[model samples]
Target: MAVYQALKTAGVDAVTIDTANGFRSKLKRDPVDLVFLALHGIGGEDGTIQKILNRFKIPYVGSGPQASSLAFDKVKAKQIFHRNGIPTPRYAVITTKNWKRILKNWQTPYVIKPVQEGSSIGIFFVEKKQNPAKKVEAALKKYDRLLVEEKIDGREFTVGILGSEALPVIELRPKRKFYDYQAKYTKGMTEYLVPAPIPEKLTKSLQIMALKAHRALGLRDLSRVDFRTDARNHPFVLEVNSIPGFTETSLLPKAAAEIGLDFSGLCLKLLSMAQNGSKEK
Candidate 1:
């Protein structure tokens, strides 16, 4: 609803349509000149909506279908990041055959996540001496594929990319053991520090890496790159959010506000970027 208020505050003639309600056919008939994609998760962030917009020749904000597809898949995004010399946590793609062996030899405190889900859905952490069979079994019942990653134990941070520039780094401190679904959505569950209280050099390094990760995936317009920095000050890229949230606690708006850009102004700026076509090269 924040996006709605921002659009109204910006004086943009906008309408909301939920693709989840089987409104694809109805949306194609709408005579709107531009589209601001605020939808997220499976059908929306995974390129399905972007393809529909392309078929209708509708100009939209943020990355194109290809970029969206590449970034939405955690395994594919990690591969792209590694190939491009970007530092990301070590991970293994699991299947039925190797899943058992992986758990047997796996180190404690590892990270487990679904290969393609977002908003940290079906993500869990296995601490030292913890039996992961129950959690793994439950997740496998719902998802055929999963990613087992060596958790980067350190401070968490996120970088916002707009156009070709990287915004200020925002440090995240979750009150829980880790930032899970509840920590992300529940109010006061986490704390954010803008322009993270790290050394200036490290801040610049993270921003540069965030931009590199963004471009490597061919993402255009705006994106948010997450990270985990260790005690040694080494930062590992976690993942990229193609269509990040614009809620009251959203990071993009927080970074934009550092430069005096209000929520309504950011909404207008995104519309301008859409009209100008910040399509991936």
Candidate 2:
């Protein structure tokens, strides 16, 4: 709704359709110049809708089908990060067969989550001496695979990517134990510091690393790369959000705003990018 309103306020002829039901029919009935996706999770960000849009020869904002799929799957994204020499947290993929063996050797202070989930859903943080057996079993039953990652016990930050540029870094201070689904969505649960009070050198480095991760995943247009640091301030890429939230107060827009790009301007810029991409193809 925010994206739609932004486009409308900017004098762009935009319409919204329910991708859940009869979206294809609506597209056939009413063709639009471009698609500005504000979706997340499986069928939305996991390349399902992107693939469909590609088959229809419809240009859309954000990354392509392959990049979207690769970034949406945590395991695949981590693999790309490793191959590109990008620093990410140590992680292992656990399946039903090998979960027991993997968990047995895992260090205490680790995280368990579904391989392809967003908004920090299905995430469990196992602290020292806490029995994670029940959590692991519950997760395995729900998801085909889980990711066990070494916890970076330090500050959290995120960098937004716009076209070929990286926006200012934002520091996230979640009041909860971690930035879970609740902290992310609820008001006042997490405090955001734009341009993150870190040293200028560290900020620049994080921005560069963010762009590297974005390109490494073959993502274009826009993305948000999340990071966590150790006590030594060594950064590790957590994951890449191919289609990040698109609201006025969303993290990406907040960063863009610091660089003088307002919400409506950001929306128009993305629309123009999609149009240019359509012409190129």
Candidate 3:
């Protein structure tokens, strides 16, 4: 609904198409000049909607089908991150078959989460010497696959990429243990510091690393690369949110506003990118 209002405010005649009813049926009434997808989670962000748009030769904002599919899978994204020399936390995949012997190389105070979920859903942070029996079982039952990753003790920062340029860093301080679903929403639960007070050198390095991660996954147009800087001040790529939240207060928009691009102007800029973007892969 926020993106819808932003598009209208930017002088674009945007249609509100709810996928719950159906995407094709919503567009059957009139021809769409462009498909500004704001769909989240599985059906939209996992390349399903992108493939549908490609079938009809419609250009849309955010990433293409391959990149969206890649970003939705944490394990695959991590593999690509490592392959491209991007720093990310160490992780091991777990299932019922190897649940008992999975901790051979893994230590306590680990972070366990669903392998393919977004919004930090099913994320568990175990403390020192704590047994994660219930957490492991719950994650496996829910996601079928879980990633037991080493927790990075550090400050959290996010780098937003608009077109080919990386925006300023935004630091996230969550009231909770980590930036979980509750901290992300439920206003005042989190504090965000834009142009995070790091040295210019570190800022430039993070921006370059963010662009590397973005291009490694073939993500284009717009995306945000989340990071965690350790006590050593080393930045590790957490994940890339393709088509991240777009409200005036969302991370992406906040970063854009730092450079004089207001909310409505940012909307128009993204729309212009889609207009000039290639419809055919």
Candidate 4:
């Protein structure tokens, strides 16, 4: 709805597509000027659709295939951040065979999550002494790899970036134990605080870190960077969402609003960015 309204307001006709079949049909029927990718999770944000768009020579919003792929895999993302000296939570990659070995060395209160899934789909917190190793093994049995990270205790904040500029920070207060899928999409489950109640310096630092992470992964147009500030107020990057949620109540939209950019304006700006990029190439 935001993208449709934005394009209409900007005097540009917009067409929405869903599923692989629909996308293929649209490509066959019309020569599209640009694609405002608003799809989230799995096929949308996990680089599958981006790969197809690239093959079709379609100019789309958000990051390219490589960036999208790297950003979606939390384990690989943390590794990239570590190699680049970007601060992220300490994590261990768990495989089915070596689950016990990894669990033996894991610190207390760690988060176990699927490597590639997003929207907090398969994330769970495991306590120190709980023999959830079996649970972790069973959970990871479906996937070849898993990510177990030392849970950082602190406030959850997200920074939205428009091009290279970082918009205002939005704090997420999850009603659940953590910001799970339910807390994310369900109404009245999470509270979003604009201009997150943090010191100016810390907020600015988080914005800078978020922009760095986005650029590090080569994200284009817009992206949302999630972080958790430790007890000492040091921020740690969780992951980057190249194609963030765009619902009226989404965090990126809220942050954009805080910085004086309405939903339509934000979408239009993103479209313009993609259009300008295509012209350059």
What's the true lDDT of residue 153 in model 3?
95
Task: Go through the candidates in order and give each one's C-alpha lDDT.
Answer: 0.88, 0.92, 0.87, 0.86
In candidate 2, residue 266 scores what lDDT?
Answer: 96
TM-score list, all predictions: 0.96, 0.98, 0.97, 0.95
Clashes of 1: 0
Ranked by lDDT, top first: 2, 1, 3, 4
* Cα lDDT tens digits for candidate 1, 74-102: 99999999899999999888866678887
**Against the true structure, whose TM-score is highest?**
2
Tell me, by lDDT, which candidate is best: 2
- Candidate 1 Cα outliers beyond 4 Å, as residue runs: 278-281
lDDT of 1 at 195: 78
lDDT by residue (1-281, candidate 4, tens digit) is 67777677778888767665676877878868788888888888988888888888888888888889889988778888888888999888888788888788877888888888888987888886777767786797678888888899989999999988999988999999999989998999999889888899989999999988998887888899999988999899999998999976788889989878888888888877987885332
What's the CA RMSD for each of the models?
A: 1.5, 1.0, 1.1, 1.5
Question: What does candidate 3's lDDT look like per residue over 196-281, in tens digits?
Answer: 99999989999999999999999988999999999999999988988788777999999999999988888888888988876634
The local lDDT score (0 to 100) that residue 139 gets in candidate 3 is 71
Candidate 4 residues lying further than 4 Å off, grouped into runs, are 279-281
When summed lDDT is taken over every stretch of 10 residues in candidate 4, the lowest stretch is 272-281
